[model samples]
Target: MGQFKVIVVGAGPVGLVLAIALQKSGIDFVVVEQRKQVPPPTAFGIFLWPHILRIFHQLGLYEDMQSIGQVMTKLENRSSTGEHLEISNSFELLEFAHGYPTMLFDRRTFAEVLMKNLKRSDQLVKTNKKVTNITTRKDGVTVDFADGTSERGSIVVGADGVWSTVRDFMRERAPPGLFSEGPNPFIAPYQGLFFRVPRPESLKPGQTVYVHQPNKQLMALVTATEAHMTTYERVPDVSERTYFSPNKVTDEDVKYWFDVPVNEQITFKDLWDDKVMGGKVNHDEGVIPWWHWDRLVLVGDSVHKVECSMSPFRGAGARCGIEGVISLVNKLNRTLNSNPDPSRQDLSRAFTAYQVEREPAARLWVHVSRLDIDLYTSKAGPASKAATFADGRTIPIVANSPVLDILPFPDEKEGVVPWRRHPKADGQSKDVKARL
Candidate 1:
């Protein structure tokens, strides 16, 4: 591996995937993650669009993911008053890009597959290495950890989630005007709670139910497994303090909102214990202001925080992983391919290209996500519903945009395998059809 090295902070999917790609490119790298162990009882599910699925397929983990996740074929939107408004089969749009199917999977299960794939490479990927500081000089970069360990690398990637220390360090060193403007202002005020419950038999597998109520609120249910149901409801921002605070949530906080009498027997844990869900109650409250600076760059939640409304269609953090890997790979291949010596100029060019290609898409995703939230939170009335539907035109249909083409760098027909193959998933293809 010589002296050339790349340091990837955060052992989350994006960081690990980037390390895998770097290793395959014959680049030496190490991953640093804060968590000592993977958390149990998955927190939420991700809807992997066709483009993202293509990336997973290329990584050769599509079969493994299929074994654990459901492929969502249809998306239904219903008014809170119980009127079906729009129904679209996402698969049809995906067919134009490739035959690759869209999927919804438990986040933990997906991360587990990525982690298993990463573990095969002992020389790469390091966990529990919490990065405390990152310094870049003329020669190389140095990453200091909380445990008093330090490693030198030719480049450092900040895949750490929002509030990234790496991003802060880069900003301090970056020349003025080098980074993009701060995130856009919030267009609306909304909040929500995530609940998990036993799946009712009436809910078909792979079906997503969206309800818009007369109160200008939204509730969504996603069916993952025969026994699991994930539910979320939009509430006024004013009520956020009651639900988001660590203090115990009382029945009074949710009682007036429900049509039926509040279930005194049910506690917050009872709703979220068996199922995976996240909302304002679980996420950090802040906006991700920037993505890249000089030798350091960020990916996933570290650079862009997504709203819940867009989650069902947006693979949020996963999309960031795919984009980061592609952008980083392209930059590496272009800059360091001929000469292994990583100069300041080489690092600068790579980071610049990455930001140029990725920032627009990131901003657009944020905008569309906000729009979805606003539409779902608008006052409920026939006129309001009509106006809401009319407003949908403003939401950019990213599925049809050319930005998606920017993904899947190098444009290869087959997906890349980041790790050695494991035991083939038996009957996985059969299950894919069954679930869809």
Candidate 2:
């Protein structure tokens, strides 16, 4: 086994997923979370696209996820005036194309599934430890925490969210010209209010709805037990786009959106009255041009964010973050296989290759999601036209998703769109791999 270890900061879904992948590859690692507990409780629902579900299948966690989540199959689009505009089976088409359902569940349950499956989670995850500083050397990196403790490892992975302290450290410690991006890589294009309520008997399980208004848009996803709703309000072109600190919904703000119609049958107030949890936040949109420098690297929202509420196709933020994690771990495994203790240059090369393979896809999602938000806020086009994915860009992206190189990919019957085979998966031919 390699003597080097990785220190993962932030114990969100992205960080926990990294811990699992590292353990499966026999790599030594530890996860440090700033929060008092991992996966901090939340009422918001999380959506896992088919491509991400395939990775869960490879990890043997798909069944666990399926047990607690509902498969989303249909979406209904409505106008603020209570007109049923259209009903699209885009999710159904996606399932048929990729052979895996789009799963939706409470965010906390998803994190719990990842944490419970880790064989050494008690030892691998540390809570209530916040990173205060990061020190990198020729041989390794040392991370100092607020508790006056430190952990030394071969490298530091910043899985923290957008306002990342580790990212700040990278800017402070790097050579003057190493990074050209400004302090704020993301901008607040829209403001959002989200809440969840008990699922109404009238709504079907796994049904999602989108309501488009003049300058605002709303989406509601109904799971087995709860219905989570998010309303996006456009920030006027003349208004300043600044990040707003998260806070509870104020009476005035709630009153402004209260009478807004979510459907012909229900208004925002009807759901808000029975809300279990609710909050407000600004939707930041953008991807960093660079993801790594020397021994320190970034993952997840620390580098890229397409706020989940803004997109019609959800979970781009978490999905891209996890994709980056898997790519990073795969590259790390390949490097350590040849040399137990890879040099700084060796690690730098690996980080660079990871950014090359993953950044473009992330950037594309940022652009695609921005367009989605724009289309919704502007109320310009056929709302249901972009919903189908069987013949769109979603199909190609799902088909070409990456899997762990060291493990066999789980078998499933071929769908309309066959997955691009990996050379190392199921002993596929290099020619087939080249074609992919």
Question: Best-fitting candidate, measured by lDDT?
Answer: 2
Residue by residue across 229-253, what tens digits does model 1's lDDT show? 3223444433122223332444455
Superpose all Cα atoms of candidate 2 onto the true structure and report the RMSD in Å to 1 decimal: 4.1
* Candidate 1, run of 10 with poorest lDDT: 414-423
lDDT for 36 in candidate 1 is 75
Q: Clashes in model 1: which pairs?
A: 58-415, 58-416, 79-212, 80-212, 80-213, 161-302, 162-302
TM-score of each: 0.75, 0.92
Candidate 2 segments whose C-alpha is farther than 4 A from its true place: 180-183, 236-247, 308-312, 379-382, 386-391, 423-436
Error of 2 at 27 (Å): 0.6
Assess candidate 2 and give its lDDT.
Answer: 0.79
How many backbone collisions does model 2 have?
0
